[model samples]
Structures are given as structure tokens and as C-alpha cells.
Target chain A: MLTVLVDGVASGMLLFVLACGLSVTLGLMNFVNLAHGAFGMAGGYLCVVLLNQHGVPFIPAVAAAALFAAALGFVLERTLYRQLYGRDHLDQVLFSIGLVFVMSAVVDWLMGARQQLITLPAWLQGRWDFGFMTVGVYRAFLIAVCGAIVLALHLGLVRTRFGARLRAAVDDAVVARGLGIPVTRIFGVTFALGSGLAGLGGALGVEVLGLDPTFPLKFMVYFLIVVAVGGANTIVGPFLAALLLGVVDVAGKYYVPQVGAFVIYTAMVVLLLVKPHGLLARGAAR
Target chain B: MSAALRFALQALFWGGWAGAYFALPEYLPLLAQIAIIALFVLSLDLLVGYAGFVTLGHAAFFGLGAYAAGILAQQGWGEPISGLLFGAAVAALVGLLTAPLVLRGGDLTGLMVTLGIAMMLFEAANRMAWLTGGADGLQGVEMWEIFGVWRFDLFGRTAFVYSLTVLFLLYLLARLIVSSPFGLALRGIKGNRRRMEALGTPVRARLVAVYTLSAAYAGIAGALLAQTTQFVSLDVLDFHRSADALLMLVLGGMGSLYGAMLGAIVFMVAHHALSELTPQFWQFWIGIALIALAIAGRGGMLGLAGRLLARWGGR
Candidate 1:
């Protein structure tokens, strides 16, 4: 039971890392970016190519993957995402879905449709026994890395000057702009940062989540669930939501093998019906 | 805009399909598929174009209908028309139950809830492999001849007529509904929910009614596909089908019944041609088309045609 909990927590942490970026974008910008997973996919592929084919070191490759996704995010935001900001939700959904399709097909073209495997370093392999409970080293590493990211993200959002501006902009874009905040620049940077975090999560999650051309589409719901259930416009909401989802999903899979993901999807719909704004609805916007 | 022109277009549309019977006999199967897809898209149009609910999980109803009809046929009820009704009835019942859940929130919430429900159904179908046939799809689904007269031949001649006839009947029903006072109320609600409510319209009731009706339409379309093809697969419930249906509706033009059919025909033909050459790469083109559609603005092919026609008429 403890082992399942640990595994669930670790996976949940990875989910938090993966879905936090989406929360910010959805909460702050109110942009329904279904294509967010494409960046994560790109990060996964980058790590695969760097570590296996190029023989880059593990830590550097992961860092490079995050940077690469950030840069890609920055470029796409300026060129493509900026135009759709004022549009309605339907347009945003369609455009982002289109982006997802294009990216998935491109990845499929470049990398064969087969799933790519990453070779974790020797230290990151195996498991460590802690008294009555045992945990995999890679999963522990994931927990540590993702935990640090969550802490850093929390502090950065609450304490930093940029975070203040971002919060203000999220609160009211027009008022923030009037207050001389570079709302557009903040959005671009925040978009890149959120995307960068997704990339980091992607690189780290490759072992657990699997990497493929369909990465974006397959995991799109997970990210959306995290953001939707966590409630937008807040960090703690998504973190807790992701953890709960991770636990529920992991436990559901382990116990009720027959039901599979039906449990999670059903829970999401019920939860949405009960709390349409999300579990943590403080300052939540449409 | 005139009645004569409208009647002529209608005649031409049916005349074209009737013409295809003799003209392109070998391509009847493809035409039948186009008709089925058009019906599906038309259902989506009722929800999206008319009711203003942007959903990504319309395939929930479509797949439900397919499985209901397919399973019924497999379990010794090989009758076609009843199979279609059973499919639609099952889908409509589910839709009625879920309408309240869907109507709870705004667009994003609706999208998520719909998607979640569809994913749940997909998982259920996948896990219940004993009944659904799992990944390999439900095989040995033997469909009976329509009305005990026209047997389904290899050439698909009977299938085309049956599907086309269903499409025409449904098209007329959809037309009547959209032109009715209830449809006008739906359009009003879509335009301004608050105002509609203030104007003494039962907004929720109307929405539920239309949503249920649309689900039934989708079920009929799915039943048609199952009966005509004599097989049902998990792909019927796939996310791609929902996305493709949305794309087809948008490509044809939203809120326009004729546009729905036109878009289906064009999209299916292009998909057939493109996928024939490179199966995977065709999706890239479809993506590009969606992006283009988003950037260019709404109304799709019919929208563009309307603009051009207006320009010519103004001169």
C-alpha cells in the first residue's frame, strides 16, 4: 500500500510538472492551447536523440531539452499564438488542435512512428528499500526533481517581480497594461516558461509516459484534467489536483485492472458537474 | 434566395445523387460513406452551428449508435431499419441523461465534460472486449437485407440507395426543425442566453431538446455506417472521428444544412485521394487546412462562395 502511494505520488509529481505550465496559460491567458503537449513531445524526442544518438550526458541533455522547448515556445507564441488571443474558445480549440495534428505528423515523419526509448544513467536505475517500503531510484529522482520544480515555481510566482506582473496581468490584462506592465511581453515570457516546464517534464517523464508521435493527443486529456480540476489562476490548485489525479489514476490502474482509464474519465465528468469551476475556485476566471 | 432557386438547388442535390447511381456505379460505396459522414456532420451542425455548443466528443453518440446497432445485429436481430432506430434510441437516451451535465458550464467546461464522457465510453468499449471485440473490432456482424427486398451486394448498389434515402429523410427533418420556432429559440439562446431567458424562453429545455435530437441524428448516421458496412470497430469511437466530423462541418459551413453535406462530400473525396497516396501524411494536410480555416475566418467553403456570389450580384 505504501509502495503504491509512493509510486502514485512520484507519478503525480511528474504530472504536476507536466501540467503546471498548462494551468498558467489557461488561467492567466485564458488560452485553450491543446497543442501544449507538442512541446513536451518535442522535449521527449530531443532527450531521446541527444542521449542515445548524440551521446550527450543525461543532465545536460535534459537541460538542453527544456531550453529547446522554451525557445520553440517563444518563437511560436510570437508568430502564431499571438493572433488567436482575442478569438473565442471555439477558434482557439480548432487552431490548437490543428497545431497538434501538424506537429504530431511532423514528429511522425522525422522520427519513425515507433516509441522511442531513453537509457537512464546507471545511478538512476534500480530501486532503494526504505524499511518496509521500496521505491525505484528513477521514480525517486523524478519526485525530487519535480518537487524542486514545484517549489521553485511556487516561490517564483509568489515572490518574483515578474510573477507579480504576471498575476496582475492575469487578474486584469487591460488594467495591468494601464499600470505599465508589458502584458504582451509577460505573456510571451510566461508562455515560454510554461512550455519550458512542460519540456522539462516531458524529458523526465519519457521513462514513465512513453514517447511517440501521438504523445500530444494521448496525454492532452491528462493535462486538461489537471488544469480543469485544479482550477485556473492559482499554483497550489493544479499541484494538489495533479497529485490527486496521479494517486487516483495509479491506484485505479493497480486495483481495478478491468476498468482501466474509465475510472479517471468518469471521475472527471462527475467532479466537473459538481464543481464546474474546479476544486480550488478562488479567483478562477473563465 | 428565391423559392424557385431553393427548390432547384434541392432538386439538383437529389438529382446529382440519383445521377451518381447510374453514372458512377462502382463508386457507390464511397458515395454512401460521404452521405453517412454528411449526416454525422449535420448532427454536429445542429449543436455547434445552431446551438453554439462547441464539442470535441460528438463521436460519443456516433460510436454509441454504431455499437448499439452492431451489437443488436450480432445478437440475431439482423433487421436494418429497426437496428437504426435502436441505435438512435440508445444514443438519444444517453444524450438526454448527459445533457444536464453538459449544460452545467460554459464552452471550456462543456468541451472537457463531453470529452471525458466520450473517453469513458471508449475505455468501456475497449475493456469490455468480450462483447465489443476490443482492438480487433467486432466481427461477424451480419446485416439483413433492407425491408427483405434489396440484398447488400458487393457492388454496394443497395447500400447507396438505402443510405441516400435515409440521408434525404433526415435532411428534411433537420431542415424542418431548424426552420421551426424551437430552432429559432435555440439560435436566440446561442446569440444571447441571458436575453433568451429574459424573453421567457426555457433556455435549458431548448438546449436539452436540440442536444438530444442531434444525438439521435448522429446515432442514425452511425447505424447507417454499421448496417452498410456489416462491421463495427473501435475506430468508430476514436477521437479522430470526432475531430474529423468537426473539421468537415467547419469546412462546409456552420448552421447551413447544405453546407454540411457539401463539406462532407469534398472532405471525404479529398481524404480518399490523399490517404490513398500517403496514409499518415494526409493528416498533415488536414491540419494545415484547419489552421488555414482558423486564420481565414469562419463559414468555410459555403461562406466563401456566398461572398463571391454577393459580389457578382451587387454588380
Candidate 2:
């Protein structure tokens, strides 16, 4: 039970890393960026290419991948996403769907539609034997890294003046513009930060879930479900929802094999039925 | 008389063009398939374009129809018309059952719910291999002749005529609906539900009705697909089917029934042509085309054509 819980939490942290970015982008921009998953996949493939093909170090490769994802996000925000602002949801959905196809095709063309394996470095190779349970050092690293990121994000949003201005702008963009905040720049920065986090999560997740071209399509639905159940505007909502979904998924797979595939979706349906506004209504509530 | 003659001439010109291509033996089957796809797109456009609902899982209705027809046909109900009705009935039933839950949610929430439902159906179909043929799909579906007069030929000749006739009839029905008071109500609902509610319109009920109606259309399209192809596959339920329907709707121009037909023709032709040229990287070209269309031709091919025509006339 403890093992399952630990594993669930670790998986949940990974989901949170992806869902949080989606939640913020959807809430603040109201832009349904289906290409977000593609960005993450791109990061994963880049990490693999750098490490396996170019013989780059693991840490530097991951960093480079994240930077590349961030830069792409910045460019997408300026070029495509800006035009989509205030458009109807249907337009956004169609445009994003088109973007998804474009990105997936590019990735498939480059990667040859085959699953690539990510090899962790020697320093992160060993396992920690807990007498009854053996856990990989890399899993521990993921949990620690994700925890640190959450902490950093919390501090960045609460303790910094930039965070304060961002919060103000999120509350009322027009009002913030009236008060002289650089709303456009803040939007770009926030998008880049979100994309970077997705890249980092993608890099880490490839080790756990292997890298595949269609990986984004398989996970995009779940990520959207997490974001929907967690509530869009609140940061912590995604964290809670991801953890809940992850645990349910792990447990369902173990206990009930027939209905296991539906566990997360069932949870989402139930949550939406109960709380239409989602679990968290405010960002600070986390 | 002159106005009527002009309208008839115009119709004949376009109809003859479609009929000429459809008369070719090799192209007839492809034309039938495109007609079914066009109908599917038109149904989706009614919801997404006119009603402002962004459903990513419209294939639920399409797949439901296909399975309904296949299952019924396998059970000795060999009549094609009855089979089509059965498919549409199943689709309408499912749509009605889920309408309440779907209508209550916001755009993104509704999208997720529909997607979840579709995925659930897909998983269920895969798991219940006995009933659904376990992913290999239900085959050997034989459609009975129309009133025992015309037999379904092996070369798809009968299927082409049957599908085209149904397509034309449905197109007329869709045109009637679009110009009817119900379509106006749907448009009003799309604009502002609160305002429609204030005006004493049963917004939720109207939405459910429209959704069910659209599902019926999708179901009929699916049934036509099975009837024409004489096989039913789980691919009908796949996400790609829904994505293709969405792309078709967007590429044609939403809210215009003719746009759906135009979009289907263009998309299928592009798909067929591109695949023939580069089998491995065909999807890459299609993807690039979609992005280019979305960016440059905001309103799609029909809209672009309209603009060019207007410009020429103005000049």
C-alpha cells in the first residue's frame, strides 16, 4: 500500500508539472493551446537527440531542451497566440488542433515514429533498497526536483513584486493596463515559464514513460481532464487534481482491471458534477 | 419563369459536374465515401459553427451509427433503409441521454466530457471483443436491395447511386433546418444563452434537441458508410475520424452547409493526392496545409473563394 502510494505520488508530481502549465495558460489566456503537449514531446526528443546523438551531458541536454521549448513558446505566443486572443473558443480550438497536427508531423518526420529510450546518467543509476521496497534513485530525484520546483514557483508567485504585478494583471487585464503594468510582456514571460516547466517534465517523464511520437496525443486528453477538474485559474488546483487522478489510476489498475482505464475519466466526471467551478476557486487558496 | 430557369440552370451545371465524376466506375465509390464524410462534417458544423459548441468527439455519433447498422444487419435485419434508421435511432438515443450532462458544462468542460464519453465507448468496444468483433471490426455486412428492384452490385454501382441519393435528400433536409425557425433559435442560443432564456426560450432544451438532431445526421452518415463499404471497423470510432470531421468543417467554412461539402471534396482530394505522392510523409503535407489554411484563410476555402469573387466583381 505504501509502495503504491509512493509511486502514485511520484507519478502525480509529474502530471502536476504538465497540468499546472496548462491550467495557467487556459485560465489567463483563455487560449486552448493543444500544441503544449507537442512542446513537451519536442523537449523529450531533443533531450534524447542531444544525449544519444550529440554525446552531450544529461543535465546540459535537459537544460538545452527546456531553453529551446521556452524559446519556441515565446515565438508561438507572439506570432500565433497573440492573434487568437479574444477569439471565440471554436476558432481557438480549430487553430490549436491545426497546430497540433503540424507539430506532431514534424516530430514524426524527425523521429521516424519509433519509441526512443532515455538512459539516465551513472550518478542517477542506482536504486535505494528500503528493505521491503526498492526505489530507483531517478524516481527520488524526480520527486525532489518536482518538490523544489513547486517551492520555487510558490515563492516566485508570493514573495516577488513581479508575481504581485502578474497576479494583478491576471485578476483584471484591462485594469492592470490602466495602471501601467506591462501586461503583454508578462503574458509572454508567463507562457515561456509554463513551456519551460513542460519541457522539464517531458525530459523527466521520458525516462519513466519512454519517448514516442504519438506520446502527446495519448496524454493530451488526460492533461486536459486534469486541468478541467483542477480549475483553470488556480495553480494548486492542478496539483491536487493530478495527485488524485494519479492515485486513482494506480489503484484502479491494480484492483479492477476491467474498469481501470476509466478511473481518471470517471473521477473527472464526478468532480465536474460536484464542483462545476472546480476544486480551487482562487490561486492563493493553495 | 426566367428566374426559375436561371436557378435550374445553375443547379444543373453543378449537379452535372458532380454526376459526371460520380459516373466513373473507379471514382464512384470514392465519391460516395466523400458524400458521407461531407454529411458528417455538415452535422458537426451545425453544432460547432452555428451552435458554438466545440465538441472534439463528434465521432461518438458516427461510430454509434456504424455499429448500430452493423449489429442490426448481422442479426438478420438486412434491409438497408431500416438499418440506416436503426443507426440514426441509436445515435439520437445516446445523444439525448448525454445531452443534460453536456449542456450543463462550459466549453472546455463540455469538450472533455464528450471526449471522455467517446474514449469510454472506444475502450468498451475494444474490451468487448465478442460483441464488437474485438477490434478486427464486424465484417460481412450485406445490404438488401431497395424494394427488391435494384440489387447492390459488387462493383459499388448501386452503393454509389444509393449513397448519392441519400446525400442529396439529407442535404435538402439540412438546408431546410438551417433556414428554419429551429436553426434561428440555435443561432440565438449560440449568441447568448442568458438572453435567449430571458426571451422565454428553453435554451437547454433547444440545445439538446439540436444536438440530438445532429447526432441523427452523424448516425445516418455512419450507416451510409457501412452500407456503401459493406464492412464496419472500429476505425470509425477512432480520434482521427473526429479530427478529420473537425478539419473538414473548418476547411469548408462553418455554418454553411455547402461549405461542408466543399471542404470534404478538397480535403479528401488533397489526402488522396498527397498520400499517392508520398505515402510516408503524407500526414506532414496535410498538417502543413491545415496550418496554412488556418493562418492564411481564416474562413476556409469557401470564404476565400467568396472574397476573390467579390474582388473580381468589384473590379
On DockQ, the candidate that comes out on top is 1
Where does model 1 exceed 4 Å of error? A283-286
Tens-digit lDDT track of model 2 for B1-315 = 257864885598458636756466787777778878988998898888788788878998999999899888877787999899999999999999988877775776677778777877777777777787857988768778877778888776777778777878888898799789889988998889789999999888888988999999999999989878878888998887887888888888877787887888788877776776644376666666656666664577778777876788688
Please provide, for model 1 over B1-315, each residue's C-alpha lDDT reduced to its tens digit, 9 standing for 90 to 100: 568877998899899999989999989999999999999999999999999988889999999999999999999999999999999999999999999999888778899998998998999999999998998888888988888988999999998999999999999999999999998998998899899999999999999999999999999999899889989899998999998888888899998999999999999999888776665589898888888887777999989988887898789
- Local lDDT at A178 for model 1: 99
The backbone clash count of each candidate, in order, is 0, 0
Total clashes for model 2: 0
Error of 1 at B25 (Å): 1.6
Summarize candidate 2's per-residue lDDT along A17-92 as a digit string, tens digits: 8667777777666777766787788788889999999999999998888888888888988888887777766667
Give the Cα-based TM-score of candidate 2 against the true structure. 0.94
What fraction of the true Cα-Cα contacts (under 8 Å, chains A to B) does candidate 1 also have? 0.65
CAPRI-style docking class of model 2 based on DockQ: acceptable
